[model samples]
Target: MKHTIFYILFLATLSICNAQSELVKIEADTTNIRIGEQFEIKISVGETENVIIPKLSKLNGLEVIDSLKTDTLKNTISKKYILTGFDSGAFYVPKQQIFIKNQVYETDSLLINVATVKIDTTKVKKFPIKGIKGEPYQFDDYKNIVLIALLLISIVLTTLYFALKRSKDDQVKTFVPKLAPYQEALRNLKLLDAKLLWQNNKIKPYYSELTTIVRNYIERELHVPALEQTTNQIIESLFDFSDAKVIETERDTIKKLKRLFEQADLVKFAKAKPLAEDITSDRKIAEYIINNMQPILEEENSEVSYSTPVVIVQKPVIEKPNTLAKVVLILVTAAVILILSIGLGKVISMSKTSKNQMENVQ
Candidate 1:
């Protein structure tokens, strides 16, 4: 009886020592969860050196969603796994094997419960499905249409501007019967008199118009470009023409013209106000100049008629329209119409679809 008692004590001590020598431990953060819910499992080993932690690849009624790397701190190495269960039932995290140096260690199994979510159907209300809603229109939806409209307006305005400008220019260049040089000069002088310029204290304008008339007459009759020449230059050119036998003019006529020009220049450039009598005298002198040059003009015309028969012909100008611009405008207009039609059709179709959906819902 004493020997049997000692042997039983020795076996019990050995069993306790083996229980305390366990190196692998496994635990779980939670044991209860709803279906499709996740939990975590932690594994620890007391030894860090020469240990290999195996991955938890499979579980019963559960999935190993994630496996963490082994962590070492001081004398402990640990691993973690994220687990999720899809079925509502009790699941087991099976024992995991770990290798240490020359021995294999196993962790105890863990239990988990996954329950289905509960809902009280009596307290919950049911709702019918809603119809599809149409989205509100945005500026971006009509951006192309607006851009095309603006482009079309700009093109039309540009075309109109050019067309009107061309028409105005053509009107300015339209044919009008020209008066003879002498008659035109006389008519302008009479018009100047009717203006009452000097009487209205418009001295400079009066002198300017007076000088312009004489210059224009000389330019048209003698073809001397008198309008572009200075007063002194005109006198010199007239003397040259006399020397060249281009005109039959007396010294008196040239002197009178020189005096008129000098007085007009004084009024224009020096701002000198001429006396009323001097203005009247200048006007008379202008008429004298015009009449004096008549005989020379008649002589020239006779010589021209004797030499060659002249015919004056006036031709009308016709400008061709911009065919390329028209073609581009037509194409762009068509494109705009086509895009608008497509957009309208889409809108109508969407409206009909929405109406039908609403009717079905009702």
Candidate 2:
């Protein structure tokens, strides 16, 4: 009795289900999708009411790019799902199962063919930036380092050169002597004292000494050449010297030396036969020039002056004169001797004179 009851319940449930649902359909326009191609899908109900068409909750291969809804004859909503996909291979639309009153319906995937595109090399895509296009090594980097090194070396060398130059400059400037003129002229004159020009009978040398004394005086004092000028020229040039603070006597002595120079030149070149007195005058003139220039020389050479050598002349000594008085005195002595020797005069005088003649005159 229980089994018969179970069979009746099952048959009644099957008859009710058959009456409620005639069919559930699901379909699509395409199944294959290119990278960017789109396609559509549809789900429909026939002879169905008071029932829900299950939502397509999942899909594969064919992406549901968009979905749409429509009201149909049975007051049912049909879903039109449009899809687009971007993959190379034949992708699939997942089987979408629909549930109506807890019953299941599934959709079939229709294929949409998508062709592989031909690449155009002529229209090749360009990268915004190309990577470094050069040799494997970077020369500029090393070059910059080398240039910097050279610059440093040059700077160091230039600094060293200037420093060395400055050091040498200081040495020379500080070490150089600042000698005064007078002392130098005096020292130079002393040098000439040792080489006596007159003692050697060297006439040219004597003139040189005279000239040198005057020249050195001028050089150390007024800084001019007394030796080089003629008397008239010197006299004319004296105005220039006098313009300086040199004493009047110094000028007069310079003029005297100028005259002496003329005399010497005449004696040397013009063969002027100068008397002893004229020569003596020359020496006196040279002495005067020396004395006159002494103050300037001393002033110039508070230290020593920077000038050439000085020349010195010394006059020869003279014998004393046998004057008339001496001659007379000798005559009286001779007369007295003659009287005393009159007795032995011939004998003594003849003997003495003969002996003196033979020994000294011979």
Candidate 3:
């Protein structure tokens, strides 16, 4: 029994020694390198659980350029240190400690040799240092500044052109009649009749003008946006007015107006041509509708006078010029000009200085 116990203790000690030997290891990529050359030192641990790598403080004749993070693969954890040396000598990378699951382990030390670069004086010729030389200026040197200045000028000119054109276009003249709305509408009807558009193969224009006059009258007198509304919408607005006791009119009159608008739409869009008698009857119906609505207008606006003369004159509408925009544009233009001038002066001065430098060297 005493012999067996001694043999078991010896086997256990051997296994512990083997585990300590295999746990941590250190290696170098190369033992010899030239001065100012970089190399790597790798530390590998056998165990992967809760391993901590000690910080490397300093190394003699070498610098720790970088330290890579620990990498885990299956059962091993590994890290790498990038080292570079500037001195021509041999250096030893000292041992590093590792902590794994509350147990301490150590890595083996490494050696690296740094060699100086050699030159042979017999094969190489020596020359004296020369003075600085000046090169001639080329267009490519200042091309960017010149191109930028031209682009800015072009943009400013384009903006100014559009602004002036818009200002000119804003000077438009509109004609507004001095006569009352009802009187003006009646006069327009008379003018339309005098034109005899349908008789001269202008049926579309005749119907368009006829409907426009009536719609304008309704809009002005009834305070409804009849001109912007569709035919059905106009009729519905009229019905609403009637329901509110705003205006009293026969349903037949509303239906007649609807029919007239529909016929005009068919003539204009669908290219339907009515008989001359039908056209004349439509004209009479337009007149009847206008006369029918005049009494309602007088009742609503009794204080309005219809004695004003029927004179149409041009009323000019001039938009105020954008003063702030013009100011900003002027400032921008001035700034660009100033920058270009400064850049040009600098280029000319540099060219002169460079020319003098070459002359002096010669």
lDDT of 1 by residue, 188-278 (tens): 9999999999999999999999999999999987887889999999999888887777776777898999999999999999999989999
List TM-score per model, in order: 0.47, 0.29, 0.42
Per-residue lDDT tens digits for candidate 2, residues 194-226, read 676555655666666666766666665665555
In model 3, where is the ten-residue run with the lowest total lDDT? 166-175
Best by TM-score: 1
TM-score preference between candidates 2 and 3, better one: 3
Model 3: how far residue 49 lies from native, Å: 25
Model 1: per-residue Cα lDDT at residue 114:
95
Local distance difference test, candidate 2: 0.59
Global fold similarity of model 3 (TM-score): 0.42
Clashes of 1: 0
* Candidate with the greatest lDDT versus the true structure: 3
Candidate 2, residue 353: lDDT: 69
Against the unseen true structure, what C-alpha lDDT does each candidate score? Answer: 0.82, 0.59, 0.84
Displacement of the residue 240 alpha carbon in candidate 3, Å = 9.0
